[model samples]
Target: MSHDDLERAGFKDRTRVAEALETVLGAVSGHDRTDRVALGRADGRTLAETVTAPSPVPGYDRAAMDGYAVQAADTFGASDRSPAVLRESDDGAVTPDAAVRVHTGSDLPDGADAVVMIEETETVGDEIEVFDAVAEGENVGDVGEDVAEGTELYDPGHRLRPSDLGLLKSVGVDRVEVYDPPTVGVIPTGEELVQRDPAPGEVIETNGLTVSRLADRWGAVPTYRNVVDDDPNAIRAAIQRDLAKDVVVTTGGSSVGERDHTPEVVDDLGEVLVHGVALKPGHPVALGVVEGTPVIMLPGYPVACIVNAVQFLRPVLKRAGNAPVPDLPTVEAALSRKISSEPGTRTFARVRLREADDGRIAEPTRASGSGVLSSVALADGWVVVPEGREGYDAGDTVAVENWEWSA
Candidate 1:
């Protein structure tokens, strides 16, 4: 590869981040793979089919408190001064003017329409004195109070949580049909990468490990492969081997340099929808599709690779697994210092948050380079600058997004 080749291969115009995301997401179609997992293991899995209650929760009417079951009319107009005297029923049935002993969650006796608290009634030798008036159906847990029969509990693509599992169990759903987690093949390509102790002119691989862990955190099954050299044939073979996966993510060898053979190989294998993006620290990323599998070419720099992976690969996995992608959590804070960024390019400036006398403050990290992994690793969150803005000034209010926070 000569200078002319590099110049020709270089990106003439970078696409906006929003445009690239839309293009990649448009190519992804919903997968049909599903798994019938037990309710105990269904947490964090996306629901594949709509789940409805088979039977109403608490099917039978029961007592809501430890009290005496009595007819509403028997306690009407009763007061502490002149309490309504009623005979205690030896049997569980509550006939007219007869009160039955009942505890919380106990099934309501036949012919009982109301309950009087034990404190409100005084039992004296086969006789009961009701001091409080009660209405029909008062202090009772009605049928289907917690959940109705045939009620829609969860829709397709809804992520199950621990509380959701409890509700499913309450409705007699021991097993649930959930969408299978998307599979991701994480390949790190670089001739200088080494597994063990690196010699001169060699570097240890970290992007593959980081990306694979991120994929697992995002609810995808990731297959982390060994490092591949920057050879066209090797890159093509590695990608072809992982075409069975839902998404293929490769780190390094994606730029326009001579050693960057990933972009060309991906172009030869399939069409490259996006070559570069107008985003800070990750402009050399590429998005393509090879044999209906989405391929994400991330930059070699650790920070850049993480940024591109979160922006591109995370959403792709969510789309393939039929899961909803939500916005990252953010908190409002005041910038302690000014941060500069190129116009028409989005910037993610890492910041450390701290509490101040007035409010929270977001201080930009000292090392703000693409290759400085510690800048992001030690930071609490990042402040995003949109494409339209040049930069943010000191004391400017910004939203610090906590990307590591789980939903």
Candidate 2:
């Protein structure tokens, strides 16, 4: 009995465990630091201020159709059988429709009531004609029709997307105020873990790289630490090494096993807010505060690490950065096999997605144990199995999580 014992001591099911963790987080006040940053470097950053239209999207009256800008009265009696065209006002505004030529997106001439599309007009002698009646303002996109002046373009805390950046450019927002992201320190524990290059029989340490990649994806900087052993003193020293960071994330020692020393170190240095959660394969997820900075202890399991990152830690990161919490990418797919879960805890099962004849099929990945990192790499994503449910049935519609492809 260790962290699991603590987890079971407090939670009857995974739902209770998650609910309590959220409750604690809800009670914690957020710390935010907002500053203006150049839009070039703000690709994935969150906005701290709501953006309003400096000017209308188009800013003036423009044409939606390609044709001759003319007075609607000029074509009032025109029909499919008969068309009318006016060769007047070739220079009244931006030159009248002397040639009855207009391209898409050109501005409508002032005082002109409508446009006769070239496709609809036919040339008879030196004049062109509209075969159909032209209505006033029919082919014109009125000023601010697409987006009005003084309107909000985007709300605060919006995580900028490529399209969002393009829209902001349209609004002439070259820079925006955004909450600075909290730097999370990533420390991989265990004497056996080796960085990048490893000797024979020694597995390469990947927690730092994977966590760093995820942090980068979420618009946060992940500071990698030198590998430390599972000793409380060494871990404390490691925590102090990155105390300037806003959050500290440690891998390993979350479980209360004989080799687990992270919990002991956190206990010695700072209060461990949580020792266990009710989530399967990740029940030992821990959260605490060290030297006035938030600390997140993720289980060393890769899939489990990713799961809690989505469930428990991401919310805090979003709040602290004032970023728009992106919705988890998901889709409805049928289960390929019947899977069962223990009655008291939620399980995030590694799943492989397949394109079936009818729809997608989600099957559990091989090497789904908590210690399996290979399974996480090969998985399409994780599936949430709720506590208290027997399991999902074969062909049952269940939610399947997918990657958020944000560039």
Candidate 3:
């Protein structure tokens, strides 16, 4: 479209939450790589291929208790009043008239179809008196009972959990092919931004580190580049350098102000697919592609940066890295106070969640301004106020997105 069309489309063309995510992710998918990692280090990594069991768990039919292994028929008539005395065998074998002593997990002796608990038997010299009868297969763990051999244990795209790694080890698997996480480059842009020890008028550059960590949590390898001045040429050079990585993220220069040059810089090098999202606190967000790599531009405010990261960048990395999209925990919370927001924009209201006598309560942090960094740090999570609605009333039950870190 031409500049006039773009201008006419302005903020009123805010992309919905789902559409923005779909658009960003749709453009960044199909970029994952695969690598073989040791089973010990495979936790939290997505499987690149299916894994089948090499061997059945408990490869042998073993005793499930410390008892005597005997033929089920041999103990049928045995009771406390009429005990059946049987000869004991030293070797792991049981005859029709004899029983074999076996401990828990010991392979069931040949000719034994059941185990009689030792507590039910009284030991006499060279013989065991049985008082209870055990049926065939009772208390016996059969071969392949836990996990069958040659079974498809884990499928491609399965994210390994701690127990998943344990299961792999149990199935005799030592190595697995996992999707290599995408490499994300974060560039913080602003002339007034300083890396450390900001003066009174200067702002500290924290978005790069914050976004880098968030990307890392999304299962991507993040590289935080140094702060770049707001100059269009400087931002352009930074973007060009960061294109070496799988995805590039720029913070602070996404707005339409004169100093906000990320959109122009990205457009000069490649194409800006999305210049503005319809989400509040993150409306200035931008999604673009440079040399076939995704480049996401975030708003300068800490809260907006975080919200856009979760709304846009998270999904992109999830697809590009082949990681399963995280379903953030949510809670039904009663709004402690009323929240006011403009119509036509989806708003993310920072909230501090508290458990009260009535129930879980969501107290608004009132940190809608993009520059309100403390609001995000103090919030437990946020509530999404959908577009076309003025706001939510007090005492309204809303779904609050819970932060996994806080939990």
Candidate 4:
């Protein structure tokens, strides 16, 4: 490859980010693999089937507080001045002018319609004085109070959290059917990549490690492969080797440089839905499908690689794993300085947030190059400049989104 070839391979018209994502996702189908796991191991897994409560929580009437159970009619006019005198019963049943001891979460005594709190009752030998009156059903937890027996707990595609697991267990659900996590193969391609010490042209491999961790965080099991040299046959062989994975992600060799050959090899193997996108710092990213598996080609630049991964690969994993994709968290802040952007391209400007007299301030990082990994690592979040806007002027309000946040 030569410089002339690179120029000839330049993108004529780049696809919009939304259209590119839709095209990539349209080629993928939801995964049908499922596993039955205990509630202890169900956290962070997507539900494969609808889950309904088998039995209502608190199946029987229970006490909501530590108190003395009594019939409401017996203590109708009880007060601090003229307390109602009742005899304490050792039996587990309460009758007229009788009280039974009960604790929180304990079953209500038989024949008891209400409970008088311990603070409102005074113990005198075998006799108890009730200072306050409670209505029927007061301080009592009825059946199905927490969850109804036929109520839907979760629907398919709902990701289970720690709290969700606890709720399921409370409803007598010891095991649940969850979707199996998608499997991903991360391949790093570059002739200059090395493991450790770099001698002149050699550089350490980091994209594969970073992308593999991101895949795991997004609920996919990732297999990190050794770096492959920048050769067409080698790249094609590497991609073919990982066809069994639900997704194949390649970092580097995605641009139109002289050594870039991943896009060509992928096109030869399968159809390339998108070659370039209207995204800043990562416009050379590509999306393709080979043998029913989605392949993502990310740029070699560290920041560009991360941006493209969050935008494309994250959603791909969610779709394959049958999980919902959530929007990133954002905070409104005033721009401390101007941010320049192309009219037709969307730019993500790294910004550091700070407290100001008026409100929060978004200060753009000084080192804003695509290759500066620390700019994004050290900053709070990035401010997205839409394709229609040219740039953001100083003091303009913008939304700084934490792209690394997971649902």
Candidate 5:
């Protein structure tokens, strides 16, 4: 936690929040491999190419009910009072004076076009009496009724759900070409950072776990690594080792402190597209490319780390997975108290929401500290104060992004 004189010199050129995000998003594209996966394992995987039905469903004309298939004209005038009298054909053919018995899903007789329910007919000796009539196509399932041949089942980049998998299976698709989830390496760096068990004054390393889980939720395979010390050589070596991954996320060491070596290491290895942003809690966020992999250096503070993950790492992961970037749900809520932000910095104020008679109410969880991770856990969503807006007064309606999502 020691600071050097050189660490006081901050970024000379800072990028606008929106521009920085855009630059990072534009630079990092998905690096997915297309491979065939069994239908059982295709759920949640994105389609690498469009899928088309090879053949029609119910491939043939068949019966749709458990009734006798008969020529439409044979039962035309059949009614309750005077039913049609017809004999069962010995050869199972629908002759002028004979009817054919069929069951549901059985193929209709060559000369039959409809089916008459058994309840509508009664047997008398060797002849049957018909009471009701059916149309030419009634009780019949036509070819391609469910799905036609050459129909597009799904487009490229479509994420398959369980229902989609059932549909694919129904259409005889046993395997599919899907874009494999990208592999991400999450590295946490800090000399005093420790794993789950921490000593006094040692910050337990949690960003790696949090960010890795977030990446996994976004359809990326995450590999969490041990914490690296604040030395430039150690940080650079870790980045080099993880360069084989599609994306590398280093938590902490992004600021200008002497202990912050991630930005310098990333810059020494490759181009640093963005070093600083006009954003609260995550101003020191850095976006760069190491070798061919996208490297994101998140702020050391847990709250800022999580905020950066949502605002920045999410899009990169989505693009890398070849999945659609879903729009986060937002709702307008009345502020319970005044919320303030710097003049030129975009602020993401965590708030706890409550339901009231008027509507939803948003109250800031904390006014001063961004490093308190518990405040983030207590918050239900965030009130995003855009850049250029100084603050909002109490009772003002503002848009808030909810954290929970229901399928």
Candidate 6:
């Protein structure tokens, strides 16, 4: 909670920050796999091991078009004024001076020059039909041209898309070994925190549900518990309930408020890797361990909670699942209006994107506060404002990270 803490932690150094992150996660032994699930159900699951293709893509030589396959040199001298004749047999057999009737996927016969397209040449019943000259080999797709056999179809950490699934099915793969998704125990801790189904003065348990949705997005099974009072023992026991799971996320009690017991509870139960992070909206983020399972303590503010969850905690769970980090999609856009922020911590604000005369512009939403949840809900993408800058203004180019781009 002091500048001295920042000095000791060296939060300004990216290498040190990354080192802190790995040290926190390295202590955790990720959850292991058990039963095998069907390919259709393996959408979010990470691949425990590599999945190889049993067969090659485009296993056969297939025609590229409805046009003709011809020996390039055969139609060399034929053109509009000087027409060439293509001989056609009663059986539609093709020869150097002849043509054959072939479908798109039909195999090429041995020692046949080419099947000149009807448009390329004018066929007068049984002539070596030609209107244009041809090269040596044209309109022919060779065997294994699309994909080579025994090549690495997908790797260990590759996430499967619909196209990837189709590729797997095309290559004769029935099943794959995928990492078992870890379970996350989310506890919303605050005396003021109330349940959706509640007593007097109780508000809906929105944070827990939000965390649950995030867990789903990050490919983890979330076991959400009811709102509990700010009691250290109660919180500790609640966390212990999901010992079988991988990571635990607890909201509230991250700051030095009177009832804040998260720090004490974490210290009593396990090691506290970091009591605070040097970031806005989530400066009180507590990275620690409880009984060896990693715990990520987040601030109670709606947008703050959401931002920290994505930029920090999600990566640990993603690695546990053996899934490659989803690319954080960024698009260069200009600011529609001016915006300001303080130095010392990075900030992410949600904004809408629109095409302007010059290029795309990011319009920052006015609803930016710890309590304003609609700001993020209405956001098309997030604008990142780094520490130590005065602010960004209209026409300033910046990278806006989108929620779903490739998806």
The top-ranked prediction according to lDDT is 4
* Model 2 global lDDT (CA atoms, 0 to 1): 0.73
By TM-score, rank the candidates, best first: 1, 4, 3, 2, 6, 5
TM-score of each: 0.95, 0.88, 0.91, 0.93, 0.81, 0.85
How many clashes show up in model 3? 1
Cα lDDT tens digits, model 5, 117-148, are 88899989999999997888888888888899
Query: What are the clash counts of all predictions, listed in order?
Result: 0, 8, 1, 0, 0, 19
lDDT of 6 by residue, 1-407 (tens): 34345446544433223555777778766566744656787776666667766676567554454555555565678888886655664454445655555566666554444555656765565565678775554555556566677778777777777677767777777677777777888989887776656678765667788887788787878888888788888888877786567888888777666677776677778777776665555666777887778888887887778777776667777766666677688999988888776665566767888887878989998525866778887888887777767568878998889853322
Candidate 1, residue 229: lDDT: 91
lDDT of 6 at 387: 72
lDDT of 5: 0.85
lDDT per residue as tens, model 4, 71-129: 99989899999999999876779999898999998888899988888999999888999
The order of the candidates by lDDT, greatest first, is 4, 1, 3, 5, 2, 6
Please give the lDDT score for candidate 3: 0.85
TM-score of 6: 0.85
lDDT of 6 at 304: 75
lDDT of 3 by residue, 1-407 (tens): 43345556665667777877777777786565788999888988889999999999989999999988998888887889999888897666888879988899999989999999889998988889999878998879999999999999888878899899999999899999998888999999988989789898899889999999888888889999889988988888888887878899999978777687888778889998887788888887888898989999999988889989988888788778777776888889999889877787888898998899989999999836778888878888888888888889999999998653410
Residue-level lDDT for 382 in candidate 1: 88
Instruction: Estimate every model's Cα lDDT from 0 to 1.
Output: 0.90, 0.73, 0.85, 0.91, 0.85, 0.70
Residues 206-261, candidate 1, lDDT per residue (tens digit)? 89999999999999999999999999999999999999999999999888887988
**Pairs of residues clashing in candidate 4:** none
Model 1 TM-score? 0.95
lDDT of the structure predicted as candidate 4: 0.91
Candidate 2 TM-score over all chains jointly: 0.88
